[model samples]
Target: MLPLGGSHAVAEGQAVLLVAHADVTTQRLTRDTTRAIFAMRQRTWPDGQAARVFVLPNDNPVHERFVKERLAVYPHQLQLAWDRMVFSGTGQAPDRVRHQAEMLERIATTPGAMGYLEREYLDDRIQVISMD
Candidate 1:
């Protein structure tokens, strides 16, 4: 399981998890697919529901750790990818949440919404997704 409960999630080495709305059927995603989803390249879940991506600010430590450890890319690289997509008019950026609380609340309330969170913040309202 992804580590949780530390005050400073990433700085203390407790990486956050990729989470989704409780009703979302997708329990596992390939790393490439997860990356695509956050990159806003994949528009729908494999189950065919439109995916709504949520993210903490790029400068957030949880966001940085998630990008590097889980997605295998730097935060700036991901930002650049999003920027290019936005500028090229091929896609838009993920919905940005102000903090982990907002990230959890947004994902829990929005159908097909997905985001990352420290495991301490997890509850039944959202489900954790595993990446291969």
Candidate 2:
């Protein structure tokens, strides 16, 4: 089986659990939807919720790899897209957290924020959505 802690599982056809600050939930996102959200390509979901995102700090290789391999995009590319969006006043990038612990803490405390971690760290405080 995959490692145990960081990820979440979302039932099919249900709203993907977005664990961010209350203000951030305005942007509800799915795993596929988040690729565009993070890439700054799609600004909002069909429901008109602005896509709010949470990210790992630059030094976190696990998150970087997740984005690069799973999302099929590189960190620099994601950053560049965000820069372009911000420059054009189209959209902004997701907020960044320091590490998995901080990410989990923030997600648990916040309402609409969504992020990822290894499968081993999950707890009762937040909901974990399965990607597939």
User: Which one wins on TM-score?
Assistant: 1
* lDDT of each residue in 1-132, candidate 2, tens digit only: 543335444332122223444344233345676687667677664456554567886557756666765576777877888788889998777788887788778777765556776555566776654443
For candidate 1, lDDT tens digit of each residue in 70-97? 8999888888989999999989999998
Worst 10 residues of 2 by lDDT: 9-18
CA lDDT, candidate 1, residue 122: 95
List residue ranges in candidate 1 displaced over 4 A: 1-11
TM-score of each: 0.90, 0.67
Give the poorly placed runs of model 2, Cα more than 4 Å off. Answer: 1-31, 43-51
TM-score of 2: 0.67
